[model samples]
Target: MSLLTALGVEKRPSCNVSTTAVLVESQGCRSKDLVNITACSGACSTYTLYSAKMKALEHSCSCCQEVVTSERQIQLTCKDNTEITYTYIHIDTCGCLEVDCSPFAHSETTNTPSRMRSRRRRR
Candidate 1:
């Protein structure tokens, strides 16, 4: 088993289930590192949005032009005494949010024609 599997942890790719939401995961250790846990716990001062307009929240993330809709903070204490925290952010994208994992994946995409073909064939 890999280190993550042995530790009861696994990393999955980011996914967007709708036009205004995305799911992502991250893991870190508390004994050797505290920053990751703190950030995931919402202790970090990241981009926050209080506006209803999607365009206004586009600058929340420096790496991409994503509009923030909501945030969920989670904290956990692992069996190994490691404190882990996870922050899940739901954002809006112009198109499909790609694997670059940043404003790349999208629930409602307008540019990819293959997306329509795939959906139609599934029926």
Candidate 2:
């Protein structure tokens, strides 16, 4: 019954979190410990398509973003041997969500060459 999934035709990239090592520094001070940073990444669906019913272009956009974040503080060793606190956002969760693609929104479009010409003329 499932043609897409059972046939392995569904091959969309999933949004998820990725990890990397980063050096944290502040005010000439750097963290003495190795810091691991996690970030939201990957491709979410984004498209611009022509709609026959509306006689216009439609754009749908979603992005991988942090759904939940936590504030974290770290101590950095300064040149004077004093410890300084630095705050950063730690990504707790990530998901795909709709983002603002255009000022015209979903119902309206701004991609056609004719429309672009009209806009330039008005300006």
Candidate 3:
């Protein structure tokens, strides 16, 4: 039984193996137990599967020109056609992933603590 079917999802003819692979990994399915696929049927090794996921993320981030913000996020469609959400922190923390952060980096904010301290000194 395919992972989706095993999990009670109806098997659709249009769904591709790549989508299934991403869904399986993202769903936390164990790599060792690809459950339904036959052995030696060109199954992607766990390393390769995850590597592809990483590359897909990098490519998606590369194409993103939108402003990065905590409230602004991007959805990535994996080669398997499965979708995943990524936030600014998600892409920013991955130093290798390039994104424009100038807006957030240069935004001005008042120092509330210092302002409070000045008020206390005035009293």
Candidate 4:
């Protein structure tokens, strides 16, 4: 089973769910590495919209004063006023709030030379 399924959390298409508000309110029980935020709709809003690709820096929930990391989950408000709650899994030992892509295998063409060149040319 997938990680989400194993964790008993339903997997959504883009991590956009209604549970974000509830999670935000219960910050005390949340992990220090996780993140949670809200999205404001309408015009003249002062809060910044959340970006899925953006890495967490030093923002902390009002309820909890712990440092946010990539290993925790986050809630972000989108441009359309939608709230997205997703978990961020860290792949590297670095403490930076960034996505690590080193675990994935490199492309075959990029990692290895063409094997066809050693074969005899077609008559």
Candidate number with greatest TM-score:
2
Q: Encode model 4's per-residue lDDT on 9-119: one tens digit a residue.
A: 333222111213243323233332433333212211111223356752222111111122246556655555565665654322211122232322466555435544566
Model 2 TM-score is 0.68
lDDT of 3 by residue, 1-123 (tens): 754355443232221222122222334322333322211112111111113545632211121122322333445456556677644221111112233322233335745454556434553
In order, the Cα lDDT scores of the candidates are: 0.38, 0.79, 0.30, 0.34
Off by over 4 Å in 4: 1-70, 91-123
Q: Clash number for model 4? A: 0
Name the top lDDT candidate: 2
* TM-score of every candidate relative to the true structure: 0.21, 0.68, 0.17, 0.18
TM-score of 4: 0.18
lDDT of 2: 0.79
Clash count in backbone of candidate 3: 2
RMSD value for candidate 3? 22.8
Writing each residue's lDDT as its tens digit, candidate 2 over 1-123 gives 543345443247588888889889889999998788889998877766667888987776788999999999999999999998999998988988888786453345757555666434553
Query: Local error of candidate 3 at 35, Å?
Result: 37
Candidate 1 yields a Cα-based lDDT of: 0.38
Clashing pairs in 2: none
Candidate 3 or 4, higher lDDT? 4
